[model samples]
Target: MLVSTRLGAARQIADEAALALRPEHPEYFSAIPPPDPKALRSDVGGDLSQLFLLLALVCLFIGAVGIANTTLVSVMERTAEIELGRALGARGLHITVQFLAESTLLGLLGGLVGTSLGMVGVVVVCAVQKWTPVLATRAEFVAASSPCRNW
Candidate 1:
């Protein structure tokens, strides 16, 4: 049987009611148990958090793969230039650093542009819907600056 009580006293009331009724109605109370709303809510929240974490991991993986592909294509297309640099007395480390620097700049640029567009999109939507924009400054800063952390 389900019984509704005040929000704050749900668990306490469930325990007290069960204790009070058990002696007079031992059979019914023995066959049924009260549900804990708090526990249920916590379990559902944990599941949703895990699901979202997995989704975020997948997205990061895809982004990394795309960046790697772009780097490989750039290297392949610039093979002649790389060979010329090597012939001009540029060491392997120099060539490597040059590519690394280029990649870092590209990542920084992409991060900044993506973050700006995303923020603008949010603001536009909020304005059209007559809703106030709410954003965490720290999160926005992290989103805009994460690419530079690789250096």
Candidate 2:
């Protein structure tokens, strides 16, 4: 019960055919034009794509804020340790570097492990569906795992 005409002239032919049948069928039958893919995509796909991009941006913002908040809480909670370091003659720069190193190592470790597990999952699913598994190279992997970027 679906009809499609590629050419405008064919559409006109179909329209005339529908009109010829209309009197016999009275109100029971009607002819409708197939949608224009480009126009439909512009109208709906544009909004949907923008909406998803916005959603991804919001998620990234929330994750960065969460990481910052957690780091702050951790430093605040380790006041005794920081004081001990200072008492042992550790300079402020040393303490700062120590915290940054700890945070970076932990973050990098988690990122690598997570990415590995995700790749494994992708391979498993692709195998199950009979598809080829694509994986990132070392440079691409490192780039994706690293967060800091210059504008």
Candidate 3:
């Protein structure tokens, strides 16, 4: 596999460097060669991943706030209906459970719809560009596939 090959090369390089460093002129022979151009790229990838995580967290927080606001508004608008239900024997806990279930369903539906839309967009872009989709070329995939790239 590509991973084993990369790891083997890295190990060979490290062993050579170790030998080189033990020579009389240690300064001339560094412990390791300069950073690999390909390997150095992963630092940028790590930064991008961190940025994506931060953005995703922010979006999730905003979505939660929006959902909370909507729930509050719904509760206010249906106060009379809720009161009628309560009078008909529905307890406060039952009402709370009903609202939570409704919210959960709404969230699930929205997620499914969004995911479908995203996939469609990706397909459209690839079609327009006449390019094959590389669904598994993400940073994690590449890192796992190439051992020498591991930090």
Task: List the global CA lDDT of all models.
Answer: 0.72, 0.68, 0.66
lDDT of 1 by residue, 13-115 (tens): 6656756778666556633335667898799978877886787688667766877788899999999999999999999999999988887787777767867
List model 2 lDDT by residue over 18-136, tens digit each.
Answer: 65667676457666666666788787967776786787678557756766677788899999999999999999999999888877776667567756776677667777777766555
Off by over 4 Å in 1: 6-9, 20-53, 128-130, 144-151
Error of 2 at 26 (Å): 22
Best TM-score goes to which candidate? Answer: 1
lDDT of 3 by residue, 6-60 (tens): 5337656654664565666545554444466677788887887788778767867
Best candidate, lDDT? 1
Q: What local lDDT score does residue 40 receive in model 3, on the 0 to 100 scale?
A: 79
Model 3 CA deviation exceeding 4 Å by range: 1-35, 135-151
**lDDT of model 2, residue 51:** 81
**Which is the better candidate, 2 or 3, if ranked by TM-score?**
3
Better by lDDT, candidate 2 or 1: 1
